[model samples]
Target: MYHYDEYDRALVFERVAQFRDQVQRFTAGELSEEEFLPLRLQNGLYLQKHAYMLRVAIPYGTLGARQMRTLASIARDYDRGYGHFTTRQNIQFNWVELAQVPDILQRLAEVDMHAIQTSGNCVRNITTEAFAGVAADEIIDPRPLAEILRQWSTINPEFLFLPRKFKIAICSARQDRAAIMMHDIGLYLYRDGRQQMRLRVMVGGGLGRTPILGLQIREGLPWEHLLSYVEAILRVYNRHGRRDNKYKARIKILVKALGIEAFAREVEQEWQHIKDGPAQLTEAEFQRVAEGFAPPRYAAQPDGDLDYGTHLAMDRSFARWVSRNVQPHKVAGYASVVLSTKPGPAAPPGDLTAEQMDNVADWSEHFGFGEIRIAHEQNLILPDVRKADLYPLWRLACEQGLGTANIGLLTDIIACPGGDFCALANAKSIPIAQAIQSRFDDLDYLHDLGELSLNISGCINACGHHHIGNIGILGVDKNGSEWYQVTLGGAQGKASALGKVIGPSFSAAEIPRVIEQIVATYCAYRELDEPFVDTVARVGLEPFKERVYARQPEVSTCAM
Candidate 1:
């Protein structure tokens, strides 16, 4: 994890004080609701359906024990007892009081965290894979470059307010766990033939009303020009991205209007002015950032644990969990464990209580380094847990309701807090997600079904990233009622693709059965060991669509 220096500390504290005064002014009627809107948004405060929601940035989804504890404290002291981890690798504290926001910001700042750039139409949090450094297939650790981008973008006067919110994600692993192609700017760090770091830059990729996979604009870009290159891209977008309509303001729209070739040319032309400027990274600066994320000390141990295998064979439940939740780590004796936040029907997806947060912090320290990672899938990750200690950690995690063992299964859903909390939501997403979870609660069935991603979004803002789910469900407004529109064949990773809509929207009551039918269709068409996305691609969406709308009259598709 990157520790905040004096400058970072000063900037955060100063912003806190400034927001404190702004909140005071708003409360005292010195600022109207309209006047306070942008100011509050800039500080990551949103006036939701019932109360204010504060989104705190967990930069690159990395958290130290102290930072996690501080977040738990904030959740305990101020808002409701729990917070929701978002797809952007940030956490949202819903039900926060307007007046207490300053205090919450203060508490966050104390732990070297802040809500800065978590919201507002500016460059948001720079996210990366949860297993960035520890992933077995990684060419190089991306956290150093992520940290550099973070420092460069944070409060940069040139990009404070873009045409719309800008999101950038970096992935260095062979598997694109960070969903890089679904972001405004996606950077893939890799080593060239000479073993020097380089970037493959993807632009115009985002999920919203208009979901588009990013196009690779520049390949094999030297890592030294990352900041300058990013500046060039942003500068082009800032100059040409639409401001007349919010829906058309994103860089994706600009990229769509102008083809990738023209867009790349414009960026290259712009890059000529700034490519070799001070923003060009130097060896010392790179090393300075890289030092913050050096690998943790590890004890020498055998590659595989006999005891771990014994425990797996002994307990079927434990075996199931280990299969789904455990991931390969770069280290010989270490493994990354994803603690599922989506335990069952009762809990909303990606939600954790304050106590759960504290327990995870304790577990992170007890099991490995005092470090925690928030996966883009809305799960907690202990990146360096010893294989020998897996059973004990699993037991502790089970006790806390964080051991759901549904990592890539249907039950491990990605859903936004829809009409329940968010004012922008058209339909209630949580209940729908719960319905799906309840319908598919059997772990064996889910595991047998295999490696399926089900995502739901309340609206087309795509907070839940429904566009990329193997089975994507988007809530739509039909007349005055809420309905769901399903999309299939979407996937994330090296072969990322946006899902295609199956057919008409269905009522909320019909969603689970629809999902069940979709699953059944996949099972029927799939070959041995075929993943859901692969099956969808092979057979196309026609079979699923035919079955889904077989009994019901097709309702007209509407805006999600």
Candidate 2:
């Protein structure tokens, strides 16, 4: 994890002081709500349905034990006893008091963390794969560049206020776990013919009312010019992106209005002047950032543990967990364990109690380096857990209700804090997610169904990234009543594709059964060993749509 230097510390503390004063002024009636809106948003404070929500950035989803402990402390002391881990690789305290926000920011600063850029129409948190350095198949570790982008964008005067919120994600693995193509700016880091690091830049990709996959704009971009290149892209968008309408303000809209070729041409024209500017990364500067993410020390152990295999054979439950929760690590004898936040009906998706956070933090230190990772899927990850100690760690995790063996299963849902908390939401997301999880509570059935992603967004904002889920459920407003619209064939990774809507929306009570019917339809149509997304793609959405709506009531006519 990247530790803050004096400069980082100074900037955060100063920002905290500034926000403290801003809050005081707003409370004193010296500043209007409109005036304080951006100020509070920049500091990661949002006035939600019932209370203020504070979103704290976990840079590139990496967290040290101390930072995790501090987050747990904040959750316990400042707001509710739990916090929701978001799809953006950040955490949200949903019940925070308005007056206590500065104190929260100050507390976060103490641990080299803050809510800066977590919200607002500025560049938000730069996210990457949860298993960046540890992934066995990763071509390069993206943390250094992710951290660089984080620092560069933080409070950058040029991009402080873009037409809309900008998001950038980097992925270096063969599998695009970072969902790079779904970002405003996505970078795929790789090497060229001369073994020189380069990037493949994708632009205009976003999920909202208008969901579109990013188009590759620039290829073989030298790694040294990352900052300058990004600056050029931002310059293009800032100049031409719509300012009149919030819905049309996104770079995706601009890119759509002007084709990718013209957009690329503009960016290229803009880049020539600044290509060799000071922002061009030097070898030394690269090394300085890279040093922060250097691999942790590891003990010499056999490539495969006999005891691990023995334990798996002995306990079917443990074996099932290993198959799902545990992922391959780059180093021998190490595994990355995903602690599922969606554990049946006990908790909503991504909601973790303060005690659970502290326990995971403890386990990160106990089982691996004192590090934790937040996956974009709203799960916690211990990136370097030893295979030899897997059983003990699994037992401890199970005790804490974090040992749900559904990593990519249907129940491992990715959902937003919808109408329950977010004022922007149209319908409640948590209850829907909980209902689905409860319906699919059987671990055997989930595993048998194979890998599947079910994502629900309360609205078209796509906060849950529903467009890329194998089965995407979006809450829609129909006569002031809660309804869900389902989509199929969406997928993330190397073959990322936006899902297509099946048909009409269904009522909230009909969602669980609709999902069950969808899954059943997939089971009937799928080829042997075919993944859910692949099956949906092969057969199309008609089969599932028919099944979901068959014998169903006329939901469109229903009123609240």
Candidate 3:
């Protein structure tokens, strides 16, 4: 966790005072709704269906125990007694008073956190792999670099109000947990043959109206040129990216229209100016950022009688959870635990009560390092749990409804806060997701349908990441009724691919059945131990499309 310096403190103090004035003006008649829109949005305040929603950034999804406690307090004092963890690893309070936003931000600032770039057209949170510092397969920790970007991009003067929102992600690990390829700017850090660290840059990956897996434009960019390279790419996009139509404004559209070669050339031409500028990080600065994130001194040996096998023998459910949710840590005896936010049929994907947040904080402090990681898949990670305390921690999570045995299983769904909360939505997405969850309630059945990413969006804005799901369900409107279109074989991460629609959209009522047909087709055709996504890629979408769209004249074929 990066601590706030005096500079950070002073800047946030000034910004909060500044926003307080803006809010007063807007509340008075000095600013109209039209005039206040961008201003409020810049402050992470959005006018939603019934109230304002405030999304606070949790940088790189890392939260200290105290920061977690502050968030819990905010939920209890400011909004309703809950907070929703976003897919980007941020937290959003769906019901907030616009007037109180500045106060909330001030509190966040006190904790060295703010919502500065979590909203508006500026670059959003710079996410890294949740396992950044602790992953066993990592070449280096990416969090310090992520922090650098966060500081540089926060309230940057030139880049605000860009063509559309930009996302940047970095993965230091060999396994791509960050979903870096699905970002506007994705960086892969690796050590070259000389044992020198470098970055591989990918640009224009996003999931929206036109989903695109980013193109790798530059390889082995040395560590010194990172900030300059980012500045160059952003400047190019800010200058030439689309703004005429909202749908065509993302960098993905620009990359698609200009082609990767041309876009890369444009960025290179700009990079010439700032490649060796003052902003290039020196050894001291990098050390300052890196010092805050050193791994905690762990016990040399186990304090408890170490026997997870005994717990597994006592509880099969606990065994299943440990096998699925636990992950490897860099430390010898420490493990990272994935706390499933995706639980049952009707439960919201990432919503957690204040009590639950506090409990997580307590558990993090009690058993593991007082740090938490929010994953891109709408789950929480206790990144430094002792190998001996897995069962007790699992028990606490179970009591709080945080223990869902499904991690990569079919029941672990990624969905957006659609019509239920979002004003931009055309139809309800949460209910549709709930229906799908209920449709496949059997854990054994869902597990058998292994590693399926079922992403649902209420509408085409694709907030629920419908573009990248192995099975995507997108909502549409037809004669005042909501309908859905299913897409097969979309993926995000190292081997990234966007899903393709099977056919014409099905009515909302007919969607689950359509999905069932597609799944059945998969189950029938898949080789032993093959996942749904693997089976789809191997067999193509023809057989499933044919089964799902049978007897429907309106359905049309689309390629994956």
lDDT of 1 by residue, 52-146 (tens): 89999999999999999998888889978889999989999998998889989998999999999888989999999999999999889999999
lDDT for each residue of candidate 2 in 476-519, tens digit (9 for 90 to 100): 99989999998998999889988898999989998888888888
Per residue, candidate 3 scores C-alpha lDDT tens digits across 1-560 of: 67778987888788888889989998898999999888878777888999999989898999988899899999999988989988899999998888788889989988888887678999999999888899999999999889889889988898998999999999888789888888999999999999998999999888877777888999999987889999999999999988898889999999999999999999999999888898687778888988888878888755444487688888888988887889988887788999988777636888888998999999999988789999988899999988888889999999998888889877788888888999888888888877777777777666556677888888888888988888998888888877888899987767777898888998877776777787788777888877677888899989987788787523321111
Q: Give the local distance difference test score of model 2.
A: 0.92
Per-residue error at 398 for model 3, in Å?
A: 0.6
TM-score of each: 0.97, 0.98, 0.96
Candidate 1 residues lying further than 4 Å off, grouped into runs, are: 552-560
Candidate 3 global lDDT: 0.86
Error of 3 at 46 (Å): 0.9
Q: Any runs in candidate 3 off by more than 4 Å, and if so which?
A: 302-306, 550-560
TM-score quality measure for candidate 2: 0.98
The Cα error of candidate 1 at residue 17, in Å, is 0.6
Clashing pairs in 3: none
**What is candidate 3's TM-score against the reference?**
0.96
Scored against the true structure, residue 19 in model 3 reaches a CA lDDT of 86
Greater lDDT among 2 and 3 belongs to 2
